[model samples]
Target: MHVLITGAAGFLGQRLVHALAACRELDGQPLSRLTLVDQVEAPAPEIAGVECVARAVDIAAPGALDASLDEHPQVIFHLAAVVSSAAEADLDLGTTVNFEATRALLEGCRARKLSSTRLIMASSVAVYGGDLPDVVEDMTALTPQSSYGTQKAMCELLITDYSRRGLVDGRVLRLPTIVIRPGRPNAAASSFASSILREPLNGEDAVCPVPTDLELFVMSPRRVTEALIHGAEVAGEAFGPSRALMLPGITVSVAEMLEALRETGGEAALARVRHEPDPRIEAIVASWPARFINARARELGFQGDANLRDIVESYLGERD
Candidate 1:
């Protein structure tokens, strides 16, 4: 198996790389070559039998990924994007990277006639918005409210079309807000979700930009990485007419997250958190559906955290 991952320097990408390194195989074949791509050169993990190639390239630039595509990776995990708040703030940057770059990648696969290639893209719950049902389903209409969501929704359609045309096998996993991410905050509107707990647990003050009652559909980094890998192995026909899958996640409110933080990090940690509203972030997050009935994903054997406490503990365990 030749596996290539974009956005390979990001936290989630790095985690996925390590997970793949440990497994050393995918879809019943041994991983022989692993190519990591990002704006910055990703660290090449030293897998015993696998050749690791780390390339620094702007995937949005013309012919940027041509060399990597020449290698003809069996599986491509497309995880690169400009994130939410940043995308909303800069439409041009968002469109170029999120939408155009994705279309280009699909075109790359089509041009090379890599019909056996499986492209697993990381989408988001942000794709669902405006007058949503209490429990959103996989086939629900895509009514995106933000530039980031719109771009993702567009990519989902392109992937589906390409799959239908026999150009490429595509799997679109619509992810939930990943909670308890390690490291400093980025530009994602959901960054606060992880920051609140991560900062307080590290004995620093943190802000809550949304209301305490505001709810979000969330997953842990562990489960998201697992889904990425599993998405590659599932039969393409299993997706039927649509190639998109809304991953299963738990619906948690800001209050519940803080409570979980309190349970894991004690009173001092809880005291470190302060509430201050930011309407910009609040509107973006508010537009997203907080509940989902991902029956299809559940039937397909996808899993989520047991509860928020476990999510918090999972981060703590990793840190320890």
Candidate 2:
């Protein structure tokens, strides 16, 4: 089976590539080819019996997706995006990259008319907002506040409509804010979630842009990758009426997360975190739904981490 991944240079995308390389198969078929596309060249991992190609091309550029989709991959994981803060900061760049690029990729898949193709997209909980219930459910409405969320929500609708028409077999995983993400921080407002943990643990000072009590629905990097891969293999009929569903995640406050970090790394590590609030990030994160009753995702076999402690430890082990 051929697999194509966009944003292959990103944290989640890179992890997914390595995870797939380790599995050496997809849907019980021997993994044959993988085409990794990003604006910057992605690191091509050497996997036995897999033809790995890394292309540093702007997928949003005209006809750029052609080379990436040329293989007619059976499984496509679309992980690219402009992110929350960056999207809010630059509307034109966000619209071009998030919406236009996504549409182009979907159209590419539709043109192939490949019924067996699995188009698994990475969506965000930013898609939910405005007078939300105590806990978001499968039936909850999408009222996105940020431009990033709006773009993702729009893409989700497109995925649903396109799938209903059998133009492409699509699945949308509305991922929660993945915490303890490895690497340096990016423009995502939620980047603070990982930064507060990663930088301090690495013996550097980090800022907490939100209040101590600000809540977040989070999953670990490991679980996110697993869920994405699982989402790819699920039968379309199992999705019932909608092809999109929120993935399960644990809700924890900033204070609780810091406590877990303290336990794992001691008072000195906890001391590294200094609260200097950024109202922009605070508002963006506050508008996101932080508690979800993802019975649908649970029934579909997606899992969350044990707890914040486990998530912290997992990050340490993975990085070590």
Candidate 3:
């Protein structure tokens, strides 16, 4: 079967490509072809019996998606988005890339009669708002606080509706803040949490944006990828009203994160990080939900949410 993966050059995208290349269907069939699309182009990996096409194109460009999916992929993983800071910085680009691009892709799949196509989408926990009731039940509603969050919330609704109508088989994984992400930091507000610990481990002083007590939910890059792929290949009947899965993650305060880092990396590593909060970042983080009830995902036979210490150790191993 052929597969299509967007955000193919991104951190999660590249990692997913490597993982997918090694995966075999339950029936023991290997993936026939893969179409990797991204805004940035890279030298494609050579894999035996796999047609690897690396293309640089704005999927947001009108009519581009229709031309790309002529083969009608059996599976699609949509990971393209403007992310938190960019979405916050430019609302127009945010709505266009995050919300409109999603609709267009889903619509493209529909127009192509890809009824059996299993489309796995990457969403975020930001969709849930802050200041929830004292005890957040599994039944609490999603009330997004940021434009990025709002867009994610809106897309979840669209994904579920598409599944219900049988136009497509949809699985939306609402991912949490992925810690120990590899690569240089960019505009994402949460970059500090990982960067501070990561850079210091490399013997460089890293900046901490939020205070030590700031609480947030997090998972490692490994878990995010595993959960995402599981969502894509999972077997199930036509989904209920909600086709989304709130993936498992751990809730820890900034202090707890640093303590875990120190324990994993030693006092010298902790000493390399400097505590300093950027107001813009702190304010944005303050409004995000710290924890969630992802019982639905757990019941579906998916699991992650390993402790912070284990995540830190894995990240350090990758570094050395």
Candidate 4:
């Protein structure tokens, strides 16, 4: 099965491309091609036996995205977006890139009507609102706070409607904040989550953007990638509602995280981190839900590792 992966140059995008390239799950049927699309033409990873196409695709620019959809990929991983903090700061750019661009891609998919294509959307936990109680909340009613959250929630509804109308098979996975991401801080509102761990591991000082008591949801990159693949390959009947699934992730406070780093990476790692909260950032982080139920996906056999330390170890590995 050939696949199209958007946001190919970004952190999780690059890893997903590499993982799928190494995947052998098409029942021994070799993958025919791998199409990597981003705003700019990014470097392609060498995958010896598969056809790979890397293209510069700008969804906001007229006709640019449509031109890149020619390959008729059987499966799609859509991870392209402007982060919440950036989206909030620039409303016009936010709607165009995060919301409208998604619709454009979906419309393109519908227009092409590739019977075999399954669109896997990478949504965020930001779709939900407020600090969740220590217990998980009901997944039915979605109340989003930030403009980014509202956009994602709306897209979720649109994706379901499109799927219901047979436009395409849409599987949306609402993601937890991906922690211990092994790179420089990104535009993501959750960038601080990764910074607290990744920076310390790199032996660099990282400023904690929120207080130690601040809590949020999290998932490892490996788990996030696995969910994307499962969403694409799993049967609709088994999945029932092909709409978004609120993912169950590791929920911990900023303090718990620091403690985790201390236990795992020792005093050196702990010493490298400093506390310095940005009020704007804190407000955004404060508005986001700390955990989600995701019982629907769990019932369908989707699950994550039990420890945050696993996420830490994965990022610390020799491989990127």
Candidate 5:
């Protein structure tokens, strides 16, 4: 299988690429070549069976899709996006990257005239917002409040339409706020979810942008990457009606997260987190729903972290 992955330099994208390289096969088919695309040059994966090529290209730029489409990839993972807070701050940039670029990529795939192609999109829980049920189900309507959520919701519809027309075999995975992320914090409102745990474990002080009572739906990077690969393996008939599937994730409050941190890294690590709420970030996160039933995901064989401790432990195991 010839595969293409956009936003290949980002945290999750980078992890997914490495996982694919390590596995060397997807759905029992040998991975022949992988084309990694991003604004910055993606790091090449050294795997024996697969030829990995990293290209620096902004898909939002004109004619970029045309150039990327030359690969004629049988499977495409659209993982690139301007993150939450960044998108909320700059609507134009968000639209360009999240919506326009996504539309352009799907159209480019349509132009390929292939018999069948699998297009997997990395969407988010941000797609659900404003007075949601205690546990959001697969049938829950997408009521996005932020500019970032609006862009993702719009693209989900576009991908669904294209798939219905037989243009591409599209599958959208509505991912949760990935916790215990490595590296420094980014502009995402949910960055604090990882920062509170990651920084504390690393012996650095971290700030909590929301109240201790604030709840969040979260998954680990390892589990989400596995879910991505599982999405590729599932047959189109499995999706049935809609192309979008909300992946299963665990829900925990900030206080619970701190407790988990205490267990993993001790009270010294727990003390490293200081609460100093940022209203702007608080509002953005507040608009998101923190609970989900995700029955569709469970039925589809996607899984999430068992608990907050497992999430923290998993990151520590991977990083340390």
Candidate 6:
């Protein structure tokens, strides 16, 4: 099987690439060719039976993905995006990268008649917002409060329509905020979700921009990677008509996260964190639902982290 992954240079992209390299196959088919696409050149992994190709291309540019689509990869992992806060900050950039590029990619697939190709897109929990229920469900109305969420929702609909029309086989995994990401914080409003744990464990000071009681729906890097792989392997008919699945995740507040930090990294690590509220970050995060009833995901065999402690420990183990 030939597979192509966009945003192959990002943290999640890098993790997925490593996981695929370790497995050396997808859906029982031997992974023969792997194409990595990113704004920057992604490093090609040396898998035993796999041919890896890394390309630095602006996917939003006209005809940017034409050559890659011409290659006719059997599966495409669309992980590239502008992210939440960054997207919210720049409307044009967000629309171009997040929504427009995705539409173009789908159009390319349609034009080539790649009906059998599976396109697994990475969406976000931000799609649910404004007067949310105690637990967001698969069938919940998408009332996004952020530009990022709006863009993702739009893409989700487009993918669904394309799938329904038999133009493409697509699956959208609506992910929660991924916590304990390794590396310095980015522009994401939820960056503090990782920063609070990652920085403290690294012996560096970190800021908590939201209140301790503020809750967040989060998944660990390990679990999200597994979900991405599973999404690709699962049969397309498994998705039914919607073609979108909200992945399971644990609900934890900022205080709970700190407690987990204290457990794994000791009191000193906990002391490295300071609470300093930022209204912008808080508002953005507050708009996202912190609890979800992901029955669809569970039925589909997608799993989440057991707890925040396990998530913190997983990051520490990798750091060590």
lDDT of 4 by residue, 1-320 (tens): 78788888887788788777778444245777888888888567777788788988786776656755666777888888888877888999989888898888888888888645788888887877764565555444677777888888888888887887878878888888887677688766678899988888777888888878888888888888888878887775565655778676878888888888998789999999988878878887877777666678888677775877777777777334
TM-score of each: 0.96, 0.95, 0.94, 0.92, 0.96, 0.97
Pick by TM-score: 1 or 2, better one: 1
- lDDT scores of the candidates, listed in order: 0.92, 0.90, 0.80, 0.79, 0.88, 0.92
Q: What is the C-alpha lDDT profile of model 3 across 1-320, one tens digit per residue?
A: 78888888888888788877767341245777888888977345667888888878897788667766788988888998888778878999999889998898889889988877888889987887766764344577888887888888788889888878888888888887889888777678888878977888778888898888888778888888888778876764523468876778888888888898788778998998887768989987777777667677787766776788888888988778
Global lDDT of model 1: 0.92
Which tens-of-lDDT digit does each residue in 1-320 have in candidate 2?
A: 89999999998899999999999988788899999988899999999889999999887798888876767889999998887778888999999999999898889888877666899999999888889998888999999877988999999999888888888899999888999888898777789999999999999999999999999999999999999999987887688788899988899999999999899999999999999999988987888888888888988888999899989999999988
Off by over 4 Å in 4: 24-29, 130-140, 318-320
lDDT of 6 by residue, 42-92 (tens): 988899878999999999899999989999999999999997778888999
Which candidate would rank higher by TM-score, 4 or 5?
A: 5
- Model 4 pairs whose backbones collide: 212-255
What stretches of model 2 exceed 4 Å from their correct place? none
Model 1 alpha-carbon drift over 4 Å, by segment = none
Model 4 local distance difference test score: 0.79
Worst 10 residues of 6 by lDDT: 180-189
The number of clashing residue pairs in model 1 is 0
Give the lDDT of residue 265 in candidate 5: 88
Distance (Å) between predicted and true CA of 100, model 2?
1.9
